[model samples]
Target: MLFNKEYYSKAFEYLLESTTYLIIGGILAVVFGLLILEYHTIWSDNWTVLITVIGWIALFKGILLLVFPKSFNRFKYLFKSKGFINFLTVFIILFGCLFIYFGFFSY
Candidate 1:
């Protein structure tokens, strides 16, 4: 979806228009984040540390979504920016690769 400009824009716009979707997504993010943290709170190893950080980020993003749904309108411009989308896509791919390496090869 990130690569597809039209679809991405449409989806983002749909999300912006639907406060109920955002609220549900926010709740889910918070629940999943808490679940992750519950088991990996120690952060003893690299994997644990990474998971913990992701959990915290999810929790923070969920809180932001729930508390400031209107504020997200300010970021709509970012979804339209091809450069930002490319950067975000690259970042996601790299992050996924890192997770894969840590999950399968680090040991």
Candidate 2:
């Protein structure tokens, strides 16, 4: 199994990159959701800003994670111990999607 190091490392790298992006994306989504909920602003005023922030966060986070995979191990341990951040993330994403859907498509 020594030969699997390459694959394992690649997998770990991708996981670290993607998870960090998702976390940052999730935070941006929530922040936008709150602004949309509280301010009643048009999507034109908020969507681009939120998306740009989230996009940049993802891009930078991916680069950082790839360059320093060791740092993410601490978060993995914290997440494993909590066991609820995943669920919270899922709920937040679902709520954000629902809000967006209703904001644009529904009266």
Candidate 3:
């Protein structure tokens, strides 16, 4: 629900404005990647595989954001509309709720 046009614009501006985010995000991604890679086996289970892949993607995304900020322009082109963000926000919320339910209440 947070992925609004304003959030997108501001996130883009923030990435453009300073290197602090890049540095912090990169560090956090690296840490998470290492932790997940060490603690979770990529082939052990679906959840482990999912977390491992996400960790790797996070690491790669952080690197790309740090090294090639212009790469995000493609995403800007694709999601330039407010309508898309609204739609995506609802999708994400629903997907996240499903995960939450499965994590906490599913038998």
Top-down TM-score ranking = 1, 3, 2
RMSD of 1: 1.6
The alpha-carbon deviation from the true structure for residue 31 of candidate 1, after best TM-score superposition, in angstroms, is 0.4
Model 1 C-alpha lDDT per residue in residues 1-107, reported as the tens digit of each score: 55586787767877876889889888998998999888877667546588888899999989988998777778778877777767877898899999898889889
Tens digits of per-residue lDDT, candidate 2, 1-107, equal: 13343454455446555756656645655555555545543346544455455445555565555466457755544344323444555677886897698679765
Q: Considering summed lDDT, which 10 consecutive residues are worst modelled in model 2?
A: 76-85
- The RMSD (Cα, Å) of candidate 3 is 3.0
- Misplaced by over 4 Å in model 2 are 1-44
Q: What is the lDDT of residue 74 in candidate 1?
A: 81
Give the TM-score of each candidate.
0.88, 0.44, 0.67
Query: How much lDDT does candidate 2 score?
Result: 0.54
Please provide, for model 3 over 16-104, each residue's C-alpha lDDT reduced to its tens digit, 9 standing for 90 to 100. 54667656766787777777777864676444366678777877876777677555555654465667767778888987887787678
Best by TM-score: 1
Enumerate residue pairs that collide in model 3: none
